[model samples]
Every structure is written in C-alpha cells, then in structure tokens.
Target: MRSSVDKAAVKMSRRWKLICVPTVIVTVIICFTSTYLLLVKGTNRWGSGRGLRVNQNTRRTGVETTRNFSRIGNREEKTRENITKVVDREQNKILMTNSAAVAVCCTDLMNLDKDKAVIIGRRRKNKGFLTIGIPNTPRSFGKSDLKRTLKSLIQNTPNDLGQSHVSIVVFASALDQSTRLSTRDIVAGFPEHVQSGLLQLIEAPRSFYPNLSALTGSDLYNRVKQNVDNAFLLAYAMDSADFYLQLSDNVRAPSNYLQSIRDFIKQQGGAYWVTLEFYPVGFTGKLFHGGGRDMQQLIHLFTEYAREQSVESLFGHFKDLNVQLRDAVRRPPLFAS
Candidate 1:
C-alpha cells in the first residue's frame, strides 16, 4: 500500500508541473507583449521624442547603450517651407495674369485713342459727360459681380445720353490681380463701347500704395481709405468730365439709375457736390462736378480728417463717416495754403 501511495503522489506531482509550466509561459509572454506595446504607443504619442536607438559605438566599450531619437521638429519645418513655396507660386501666377491683363487693356486703349478725334467731336455735342470710377480689390474680386454691374449700367443708360459721353474707369488695387484680369476680359466682351472711348481700364502697381493686407485698423477703415484713395487718384486724373460717379463692382442699379442721375444733375444746376443715398443709412458716392473744384475741396477735407486721426477712429456707423465729412466741409479751412 505504501508503494502504491508513493506512485500516485508522484503522478499527481507530474500533472501539476505540466499545468504550471504552461501558465508560467503564458505569463511571461503577456508581460513581454505589454512592455513592447507600451513602448511603441508612448513613442508615437510623444511625437518622436520618446523613441530609442541602439548605439553600435557601445560595442567598443563592451556595453550596450540606447538613446532617444527625434525628427518631428525637422518634419514640421519642412512642412512649413513647402506651404510657403506653394503660396509664393500662387501669388506669382496672379501677378502674371495681372501683367497680361494690363497689356491687353493697353492695346485696347491704343485702339480707342486712334479714333479720339471723332470721339471728341461727338462729345462736344453731348449735354453732359459722366465718368464712373470703380475700384477692384482682392477681397471684392467677383467676376460675375463686375460683369453684372457693368451690364446693368450699359443697359440702363438713358436713351438721351450718348454712350460717347460716358466713361467707365476701373482702378484695380495692387493685390487685385485676379480682379484685374477678370475685369479686362469682361470689358473686352463689349468691343463697340471700348473702341468708342467709353470704357477704360487701369491697373495700380503693387507699389502704388501701402500694403492693404498689412493695414492696422478695422475692415471698414481700410475699405474707406482704399476707396477714398482710388477715387482721389481717378479724380486727379480726370480732365474734362462734367460728373464723376463712383460705383462699386457689386452694386446693381435700377433701370432708371443713370437717367435719374442725369435728371438729378440737371436739377442741381451742374456745379454741386451731391451725396446720393442708396440705402437709408449709407450713401452712394455720386459726386457731381467730380474731378473739379468741388471734388478737390472734398478730397482736401477728407485728407484733413485722415491726418487728424491717422484714420484710426474712422470706424463706426456709415452715417458717422458721412457726418465727419460734412462737418469737415462745414468747418473753415484751418490753413488756406
């Protein structure tokens, strides 16, 4: 019986060893897998700063060593550089298009001038002349909007007003390359009017004015400054227009808009500075006798206001801007010089 019991005990001990061996192996495998997984996850989460590298130099010293390896920062720098290059390329394309548009417009201008003598003769018999100045900015570069605006003006022009007596002047700001090209294309569609000296396109060089994108002020202030500057330049260049009307490329006028303007001018007796209200709050810039003494006076007053505050406080309601202008005009000139 003692011999049998010893044999059974030995068999039980062997069974337990078999089960324990597999359990030990499984535990070791689990520990190793968890360690490897943790290292990999940590390296990925820490943005390349937590990775390890085996150093072969340690073999010379009879030791094993590891060091952290990182390339995330370098990768980010490369990404930024690539982005800048793309932006520069896009800007170059825009500039190229702008140049092409300017060239084409110039050619059109030359053709128009070839027949200037005939145009001048027709203009002499017209009752009144109108010069329309439109400024195109990068932000406001909508081809459809510009086309619609110009088409509306052409379609709505009073029957009594000769097309030769009207001039549409476009001033494209420096960064408005796309707008310039698009506008030139649209104007080209109307060959008869362009050849008649009724539509003129002008491009302002990128260096003509301060960087509008870098201006430090409210958006309204920047817009006001740009519009005023464009109007001032256009007026300064005007030589023989009886009225200078400034219109935005986005505004769509009524069918009678131009006719109403003519009537209004005739009613006002031709030599006046009138601010027409489009909306109840804001006024559309329709300076009668624009590019004349009245316009010069208005520009002078605007310059004074711009100088007084560095154009910083020129924000607020649109009415307020108009009020400031009226007040500036009412106030006596501080210096006649």
Candidate 2:
C-alpha cells in the first residue's frame, strides 16, 4: 500500500510541474513582446523631427536642440529662395514677350498732361470715336475688377463699332510699385487689345495733388479729389471721342449696353449728356455726351459744386442755374442790342 501511494504522489507532482512550466514560458514571452512593442512605439514617435521633444532643462543648452532649430531655419530659408526664384522666372518670361516689350517702351503718363496721353494699340476707323475712362485707386480697385470690366466692355459692345473705334484709358493714380506692376500684368493679359491700340494705360503725375492736405478736411478733400479725378478723365475722354463713357471699376455692362447708347443718341439728336439710371439704385454718371462747350462748362461747374459744405445746397444752386439757362435758350433772342 505504501509503495502504491508513493508512485501516485510522484505522478501528481510531475503533472503539476508540467502545468507550471508552460505557464512560466507563456508569461515570459508576453513580457518580452510587450517590452519590444513599447520600444518600437517610442522610436516611431520621436524619430522624425516633426514631433521631436526636448526636455525643458536640456532644451536650453542641448546641442541636439540647437541643431534641430538650425535645420528648420535652413529649410524655411530654402523655401523662400525657391519662391523668389519662381517669381523672377515669371517676370523674365513676361519681359521677353512682344506685348510686354511694347508696354515697357510706352511712355509713362503720370507726368504727361491730359492732351499728351500716349496711345498704344491699333486705331480703328469708324463713324465716331468712343473713349471710356477708368480711374483706379489701389485701395479700392484691383486686377480682377479691371479684367472683368474690360472683358465686359470688349465682349458686349456692338461689333459694328469695332474695338478700334473704342479707346480704354486707365488712370492709375497714387498706386504703390507693386500695385502698378500688377496693373501692368493685368493689362498684358489682353494681348490683342494692347497690340491693337484700343487700350491705353496712363498713370497720374506724382505732383498732380501736391496740396491735397491743404484743400479741405479729410472727408471733403477725398470728395473733391474724386471729383477732380473724374473731371480730368472726362476732359481726357473729350480729347479722343465725341462720346465719353465714364465707368466705375465695379460696374458690369449689359449685353446690349452699346446698342442702347447708339439708339439713345439718335433719339436725343445728339444731346449734351445722356444720364443713365440704374434699376432701383437711381441715376449714375455712366454715360455722357462729350458735347463740345456745354460738357466742358458742366464739368467745371460740377467741380466747383463739389467743394461746398452742403451737397444739398450745391445741387439746389445747380438746379436754379439749369432752369435759368434753359429759359434763356428757349426764349427768342432780341434783335439788337
């Protein structure tokens, strides 16, 4: 009985050892795998410079942190250099084009008087001339606005009138160098028009408004300056065309706008000016007949009116003058005296 019990006990002990040994092997494998995974994750997270971390105490004096910062700075500098190179290449390409060459050769109009506007592009032979004036203030106007305006004018005008019959004179005044460059670039986009002499780009002379500050208070001064600019544009347009269309940069033309103007002129028998009324917005100085003396007198009168303290009073005075002038013209002239 004792022998049998000893054998059974030994067998039981062997079974227990087998179970314990396997459990120990599995636990060891799990621990080793977990440690290896943690090491890999740590390496991945900190390996790239993108997520590099430096301890607060070490960051101040560590050579590694210093090197990393230098590397980043160099990378940024290289990016800037690349951008500058691209810009230079683009400008050089523009300079090489025939259109750009002509633009560069054309005289700068800033110093030139209204009569001396240098005409670029082709001149068309038509029944009458039409000059469109566009004044650009960099603060309010931009390349996209000019492009849209020009495109509308070109595409919507009557084909019979032809692009040659119409002249576009852009008055670029008080713009910075970069804005002027951008304007030139915008002008360059219309290669056909620029080459055809239908488009003329002119700059206002630097000394045009030398005493702008002395003119009036800031608000009044801006108003007067705008009036003067419009007056100058009108005078310039009169020099080239019998009919002048003064347009704001932001306005879009209807497809039949040119045809409508022609019809209106015929209906009025060549009226001094054709005031356009925008729907819901009221009257605008969009269209005007460049009638010889009458238009000039009106422009001068308007300029004076713009300087008054009260705009309501100015218009009131104008209404009175207009009524008197109309009556005088309508009444029969006395034979002598």
Candidate 3:
C-alpha cells in the first residue's frame, strides 16, 4: 500500500509541471506582443518632427511680401521673449507667447499662424555646403513649379550628399491665413524631404522689417522690401553652408546643373568672386559665397544701395567693386528663368 501511494504522488507532481510551464510561457509572449503593437502605432501617428508645413511661409509688408532658409542654427543670452517652438513637441500646441530669437528650429507638428520667420522643419541645421534659397511671395505663393523644382533638385542631389550639404529653402513669408494654408498644403506634399532635412520653410521674424510702411512706392521703399526679403533669405542661410544658390520660384535646371555648378565653384579655388550667374535674370540664378562677413556685406549692399539701383544692376555693382573679373556665365547654360 505504501509503494502504490508513492507512485501516485510522483505522477501528480509531473502533471502539474507540464501544464504550468506552458501557461507561463504563453502569458509572457502575449504581454510583449501587445506592448510592441501599441508603441509602433503611436509612433506612426505622432513621431518626433512629423515635419512642419513644408508648404507654408512667413510674411512681412508695404502692400507687402515675405522670408528664410531652413538650412539651419541658434543663439541665447540676447534676451528674447522665447519664440514659440520651431520644433514643438507640444502635442497640446497651445499657442505659446510670441517673442524674438536669433533663430528657432521646429521638428514636430504645431500651429504656425502667429510666428513670422520661425524656422519649422526636419532639417533645422544647415547640412552639407549648399543651400538653395527660393523667395516665394503672395503673388505666386511658391505653388507654380515648386514641386517640379524640388523634384529635380532632389533627384540631382542624393541623400548623403544632400543630407550632408544640400538644402532647399523656400521663403513663403506671407503671414496671412491664406498664404499660410497654401504653404502648408505645398510642403505637406513633400513630407519625405522635410524629414530628411533636405528641404525647409521659413518666414521673417517679428519686426524683421524696420518701419518701411511710410516709404511705400519710393525706390527706397519699392524694391527695398523685396531686396530686404532676399537679404533675409541669405541671412538665414549664411551659417548653413559654404555656398548659396539663389533662385526664383519659377525656374528650371538641367540634369547636370548641380555637378556643373559644383565644378565651376571648385575651379574658382580661392578666387574672389561675389556672384556666379547661371542665366543673368536678376537674382534668379545667382550663387553667392556663404561666408558670414561676405554675405552680410552683400546683404547690407542689397538693403542700402538697393534703394538706389535695382537688384540686377546692384549685382553688377557688387561684382565690379569686389572682383577684377569673375566667371559670369557657364556654357550651354545650367539654368533658365
């Protein structure tokens, strides 16, 4: 009777082990699987820098116009009121206070109506050595050919090369609701570029313009607004890279334009050249050196002398004063207006 009881006890213990081990294993697997799914779903819907309105812009005035290069940087201690986040993760997006800062970069979704020249996009920092600055205002709104232009530019520029050195900055600086919405629509189409930091949108900052309302239609007032706009564009890009290519909203480039421009700029090796022209259509296809001092000087010239001479003519003036002779044209033309 004792031997039979011992055998039964051993069988019962073995059965319990077999059932309990499988149940524990299944429970652990289910917990991990559920947690992973939820996390992934959350990220897809709300990730860091879902990308700012790649399509929107910042604006300014005088019957007026717009602003910056998202090719990107920053500063502190200048005593700013804290610009609303350029890359605000504030899912709450609770319209924050408006103040001025040297620069602001945004990587997440947020309201953009109140801020001007706020840097909002994936590529907040200046990447690579080239920044393409396109000034699109209310008249055109950067809608015409902007997509095509971006496609070609991006196609010509690869990821590593672009992420490292190339960024396209569209100045859609219209502060109005219409312009803002329009810009958002356009940029939303290129979420990929925004994420990659190859493209960005910017507007002018608060008080970016210095009381030009009184001088409307004066030569000092007329083109100064636009020239100043360009100056702002270049200013935003000054720290972005070694070279800046200024283009109009409606322009086209050849397949080899990027390579050709690279080669041309390289050939200048240590040469003193202020403006390299592609098509001679005002500032449509002009490339300027991205040196801070050089660009600031040129920007100064644009804002001050632009009141006297037109920007196109001013280009010639800058070249004449700055260099004995710089290459003004590239053969077969690399770009067209």
Of the candidates shown, which would achieve the greatest lDDT relative to the real structure? 3
**Per-residue lDDT value at 6 in model 1:** 100
Worst ten-residue run, lDDT, model 1? 328-337
Candidate 2 runs further than 4 Å off: 1-112, 119-127, 139-144, 158-160, 215-217, 269-285, 302-306, 309-320, 323-337
2 versus 3: better TM-score goes to: 3
Candidate 1: global Cα-lDDT? 0.47
| Regions more than 4 Å wrong, model 3 | 1-116, 123-127, 140-144, 218-221
Tens-place lDDT per residue, model 1, 58-175, is: 2211111221223222322334345334334433432244465434433332233322322111222333477776665555343436777777777776544636567766555434
- Candidate 2 structure lDDT: 0.51
Writing each residue's lDDT as its tens digit, candidate 2 over 96-145 gives 34554334222222123654444334333442567777776554333337
TM-score, structure 1 vs. true: 0.47
lDDT per residue (tens digit) for residues 193-235 in model 3 = 7887787888775466657777766556657677777777777
Superposed model 1: Cα runs more than 4 Å off: 1-128, 140-144, 158-160, 174-176, 211-214, 217-228, 268-285, 301-337
Better of 1 and 2 by lDDT: 2
Clash totals, every prediction = 0, 6, 19
- Model 1 residue 49 CA deviation (Å) reads 70
Give the per-residue Cα lDDT of candidate 2 at 251: 59
Candidate with more favorable, higher lDDT: 1 or 3: 3
Please give the ranking of all candidate structures by TM-score, highest first, separated by commas: 3, 2, 1
